[model samples]
Target chain A: MVKLFAISVIRRPIDGPPDGRCVLLKGSYDLASFGFFQRASVKEFMSFSSQTIVERTSPATRQSVKEQEFFCHVYVRVDGLSVVLVSDIDYPSRVAHTLMTKVLDDFSSKFEWRSVGPEALDAYRDLDQTLAKYQNPREADALTRIQTELDETKIIMHNTIEAVLERGEKLDDLVAKSDNLSAQSKMFYKTAKKTNSCCNF
Target chain B: MSVIKKVHLKGIPFNILPETLLLAINMSPIGGDERNGSNFRKKVVIIDENVAELCDKILQNLSNTIDKDDLLDEFDIIPCESKLNQSPVIHDLTSHKVALESWCVPYLFKHSYHQFLWICRKSRKTSSTSSSSSTIQSSNSGPRRDSGNIASAKREKELSRKLSCLSESERISKGLLLSRALIIINPELTLAWNYRRDFFHPSSLEALEKEQRFVSLVMSRKPKCPEGFTYRKWLIKKALQKSLVEPSRIQDFISQEIDMIEQPIRSYSTNYHAWSYRFWLLELVLTYDKTVVSKDQKEIMLDRELQKSNTWIKSNVSDYSGCHYRQKLLDCMLNFCSDGIPLLLKELDENEKRIFIFEGHESLWHHRRTVILLSINHLKKCKDNNGSNAPLSSEEYGGLEALEKTFQDKESDLVQQIESKNYNDTENECSQLNFKLCQAHVKWMERRLKWDLTKSVHLEV
Candidate 1:
């Protein structure tokens, strides 16, 4: 079955880089195999990835990450409020970006994102429902149909997470250097990549 | 000393060469009783630059690791040059999920070469002789299982000395085992599949069952293998021709075949081989053994399959193969009986809702088109097969009028639905691809088939 694993609303401040403390985040981590630690590991990876991509993203621009068998889409509004969704490879990229945009527009309107801090904004529970509703991709049909008329070429496509990074920097070095990731999370990252590169389970 | 038992080898030419080399093989006895771990332990490695060495090395491991011996399950053929520092691995898919651990083989399969490697585990063993003096070598426990260290050239020469010293019949038996190993590693090797086929002569029920089990293990490793499915079909057809299975149990046999194929379909998305194999199985049931499977049973089985297809399509909405299959089932159902009209109506209703929700998918549209065409053809058949030149009574035309109303509603609402989706699009610049495709389907039905579902006159019987 197709899956939409995670969704988050991250704010990219005018600073060195956006922190991992996103205003809103929700995901389903049942796809991972590491018992008990699966959710946390998936959360860590998604947060780490979202923060990295959100920082690189400019205002009013959108980009997507197409990894091995999964895709991560990040669509940021002109106000710097970003929405990110990670789904399986077969999920339509256009529908995914459309969901992010529609959710961003609706979520931003309901809550005062500019004035509220991360703690206050976390009280908004619409993201969990949004992720569940859009997991089918059809639930967002009405909005996506309208989004189809827009110029899809405006969305940039990067084949790998490494492609979005600056030159001379590897993803491994970043994972090892990041203070936000725990030692176990980094170990999970290494093992997951190693096992997948040779023979996928 | 190896066991003193009768093992015959049907020989094949060993002159042809292989592309690459490095083989890691672990053999499990094909028969159920070959677990003594004492026979076939005389390892013979050959020192040659040709493919003959690969065969000799296979026999060495086959003897060293095979506790009992009939046939072994070959896992993978790893190319030796990658330097992965990993040995040949076997995934026990029967009981595990998200797991691909290397299983323990009594004898380690070690290949230190640059060309070809073969891996195996005993599915079953059939040898009765257990008088050998070799000790049971415990399998090493690790994430990966090494086949064994590179065979020493001196030991290989010593083992060959024994082979040269063997009786003439023993030499022939060894040749048969060598071909078996080679065929499993490369299932696509048709020449070898039929080569071993002539050797096995699987006419008896027991032998055919054993062969089926052996092929199933190979399929588990490679789920979408067309060759595997085709081989299975050949076996079943042979059985049917020979009347090996009872006629009463033929339905159960075909049902079992359908059950076996679902695994491959589930493992690999949009599996063409599995789906085609399914269609063939249904066709076989329809045509074969009609004496026992009454018309009612056939219809019942078809109805069940239609429901199964819809359930599968619901979960795997993106898989168009399932939709294609569902359409085939629809064709069979409608052609078999007129009760199919109501079921067709229910199916179109579900498809209509699905199209509205997932309009981005072309599969739903394609299936919907097939169903509409089928319904139009059904109506056309009714009108053409009029018993007399008189128009039908009101009751005779009621069911078809319902169908006509549905077609009219769909055609009229399609344009409105497309326009309502986007506010910026006007009538002149409307370029909704989904809507356009639906319109094309309607046009093709009227212009090509010459039977328009949207018109009431076409349904008058």
Candidate 2:
């Protein structure tokens, strides 16, 4: 029942121009979960998670938010690369972190950190195989097994995005700060907000 | 993983190809091999050209010699000279022939009417000749004629018994039993499926109903198999073609089909096949039975169907298949109702409420678009038919305006609710979701109103 819907590798700028964009390295979504995100572009998905990262003032680097019907686990590596795993709520958090770590390690070894672009991402198409192999959490790799035994305290499970964000931080401010959003997506969010003003009545 | 090896052989008929014969060979695991878990390694042996020719010759000879009566016998494997003069390469050919014979027997028995008549003629001639010889009253040949007469009577009785045993109804029932057993073992067997279709008597309602029940049983067992659904569709068409005498029965059959499909649709959320079949049934009923189902009756049925769909959509908000079927049902409803604009407006209102409850649900939005288009079409048709500037009824216009006002009121209330919630003290996820929902509702209503106004302008033209 704990099916992995999608795994995406996104590259975020560390100290570049304010116009830093999040590029989708490789992503695979199952057909069953196709309905939930059928209209959402990769940029929208990136914006959803990147917005959370921009909002967080605390030292906690990992977050899980219920998006649509699945829990999207966002694990931001030290070098600004993020591995997002979307799975059902029942999916093990430790397994998700381990899978992210393995994928990140494999991705980093195969591609240069500074040279993160479409070409660099294309050089590592084998990551799709890793995504498929790790879909079954029971088939965890060596790191997953070791972490489950030795580092139980490192896993931080947040019930919602708000649980991790500071009190003064608003989701809207974070969304506005996200640089990955396309013009069309921005217009859509604005239109959606305008229509949602019905709540004000 | 153990690798599979393939060997291609030529000059074999497509029906007796490697894939078909491999399926016939029953392979069971011999023992547990600790590494792979099974000791049996599945192998397909492709015989050389010589064996293929020998197989063809053996089959041809068997077909020539084996009559329908010989096939009906329990253990009689037809003997061919090809088998008697077989070489070492074709030693296992006899078993293959036996298997093929048994497999082909049921098909031949069901279809070979010429063989049945041939046996009838043979029995009738023997009986008549013997009876005629005895009536000649020749003293010297009296004993011989009497003996012949007794022999012919016995032969005639045997032949008649065999003929009754292979009667059409009996053969069909036997075929049904065999196919049911065969399908249970391997539901993908197209040959078995095709063979079963030969037994369906189109005019017999009872036979058609039984076939429906059997297919339902099959679908319940193997929900993913398309063959069962196809067979069910064929049965429904046959039933419809025959239901001209009592057209009400078609309605009953359709209702039963809907009831049957509800389980599969609920169990598997996006079963496109079941949804397609439901659409087909509705189209058949609405279009095919105009004389049988009166206008009033069709309206009532459509209303009931609409209510049923409303319940389905309420429970299954994300299932696009259900939403698509609901749109089709609405299209059918528009055919019966003269004032469809109000109905469409009401549906649009309901869809907005649903989108508010379940934000970012794309199917609901799609359904709203469909409703808008249907309303526009209805308005155009009404103007064309009535030749009036104001195509819509005054009451319908009043209903649309009232619905628009209600949407505005809901939007404002949602905004007030969001504004009143304390940002810091509230549960972040709940408040954020509510905010997003409110935004989505407002956006959808804005588009809905714009489309409605555009269509209303079209009505003026």
Candidate 3:
């Protein structure tokens, strides 16, 4: 079931205070996963949310959507395949990682092209079930193609895990420092509510 | 013997400890209870040893507030106590003094101190077993007698007071008191019924179980009262919901509710609300049963329901919601009217057109048309099977004639009204439905006439 696919995450910056862009972005992402990305990009970005520019003075803003168009050139290039996605809002990094994971998972499951994580294993299991039910020559050939891609993802996951494991105490120290910072941030939020004021951020 | 000196105690602070110094006082005793003409002298005053000491304290307190010489002229602060052993002044004390206290005991209750003060006169005149018998002595002007009686009296007074303050349990007790009071006053105070409702909340399993018994009690007392009937309706409706998905369980719940409404032991009067609730219960029964019920049983039940609610229906004829329930009861009776068409016609006022559930002023006409059409359908079925020689009797013919007259009258009026009105934009769905029924009834009657004539011709041949 393996198929050749592309996945990436991009950061798009907007000027307004975070009124409602995150909701539109999440909707667009869900639509895109359902193979409705192009339709959603126009409607959500132009009609639903503030991702549109008026009268086409700036060609760059007019290129794609008013929101994603600004990041018009931000794409990830890997194995000669490029993919564009959303970033630059609050939780940009987390959203990017999740989207990348979903896309990678989808590609590995569909085409058997895998790089890291359990995506290859899931694809193999699905293929195994399908083969049991179908028992077609075409499906058998697809499974053989996926097997080749699966090996590549397994090696990538192992390498990533090994690299992270090598970092040891430095990573733990960084995580501990982040926890402390978050605790302080919560205290600041409490103080703001007591003083009847919004968060400074 | 001198007269029993009357005393008044007022404005004692709630926080003060009670002083037993006045428990030993003596006064004149009552002689007998042989009607008004009985020769009973007022007993002579006997200032005992114990009462005298308490009287000295009373004098001291009176002196502290005012001059001692002016005490007899002003309101005298008298100290009274009952003696331990039975004595005559003890009877005198019961006639005059009241045991008033600021603080209350925890549970045992008696009449209010003011009420007891009124009862004191009766207690003194009647008997020596009066509670004041234990502390006062004749002819000894000193404070020396049993202290135990004083302590117990204080305890009894305190207990009665505490009973007054039983906040949580007060409502049920108060409701019972008010119920008894209502029987004495105006028994028609529906507020007493509401007081009973407020006594229970459906918060716990125990409360729900108790609520069942509570409803039974209320209905038992006042079966015709709307409050009890409505509350029972609510309980049955709740039980109906829990058992709604199952038909037999719903039937059982409905039967239980009907029993509460119909067979309340103490009061046997039927309630309109209860009858209407039974109607609603039957509707749900119809929905859930989805199976045919016994015709005889259903008719009997509906007849009883209508008879019970007849007064309410007559008063609330303009109440369309209530009319809707009547319509349902009619429908149930109709189901049982399979054996005899006359029974159905009678239940529906012998006017088929008035049996409909349509809204607005035309509902009577609409309903009448439906009933006529229904009769025509049944008669045509009878004629189709050539059963004119079968069970077709006077009752059936009379039922047929009534249906035909109702249909013809209603149809002529409806047609006339429709012809006069502009039907371009007015989407009278109900009128349209009635028109359909009118057409159906006409066609059925035509067929029935043809069948009946053909059968008669065959008989003549």
Among the numbered candidates, top DockQ falls to: 1
Model 3 misses residue B273 by how many Å? 3.7
Against the true structure, candidate 3 has what lDDT? 0.34
Instruction: Choose 1 or 2, whichever is better by lDDT.
Output: 1
List runs of model 3 lying over 4 Å from the truth.
A1-201, B1-217, B241-247, B263-271, B287-328, B332-342, B346-461
Query: What is the Å distance of residue A167 in model 3 from its true position?
Result: 99
Q: Fraction of reference contacts reproduced per prediction?
A: 0.07, 0.00, 0.00
Q: Give the per-residue lDDT of model 3 (tens digit) for B1-461.
A: 43442222123321232233233222233345423211112222233334433332332232222211221111111111233221111111322211111111000011222222222222232333355663342212122224457744564454346344545355345344434223211224454445544443455433454456545533432344455556666665555454432443444455555555544411222234555666666665554534634434444556666665444333222334344555565555545454545554564563332322221333344444445555556665665766553224435446445545654554445444433332441354444554555444444434643322222121111
Every model's Cα RMSD, please?
13.4, 21.9, 31.8
User: In candidate 2, what are the lDDT values of residues B94-207, reduced to their tens digit?
Assistant: 222111222222222222322233333433444556786643433433353367676445544644564556755565554455455445323565656776665446567655
Query: Can you write out model 1's per-residue Cα lDDT over B132-176, one digit (the tens) per residue?
Result: 432232222121235444454343444445455645345434544
Estimate the TM-score for candidate 2.
Answer: 0.42
What would the TM-scores of all predictions be? 0.60, 0.42, 0.25
Q: lDDT for each of the candidates?
A: 0.58, 0.53, 0.34
Kindly report which residue stretches of model 1 are placed more than 4 angstroms away from their true locations once superposed: A5-14, A17-27, A30-55, A58-70, A75-84, A89-201, B1-87, B90-94, B97-186, B201-217, B242-244, B387-405, B422-431, B450-461
User: Tens digits of per-residue lDDT for model 3 on A1-201?
Assistant: 101011122212333343322111111132211111122223233221222111111212211121211221122223312223332121112122223334434544455232333332432443223223321122233343444333222111111111222234342343344322343232222222221111111
- DockQ of prediction 2: 0.02
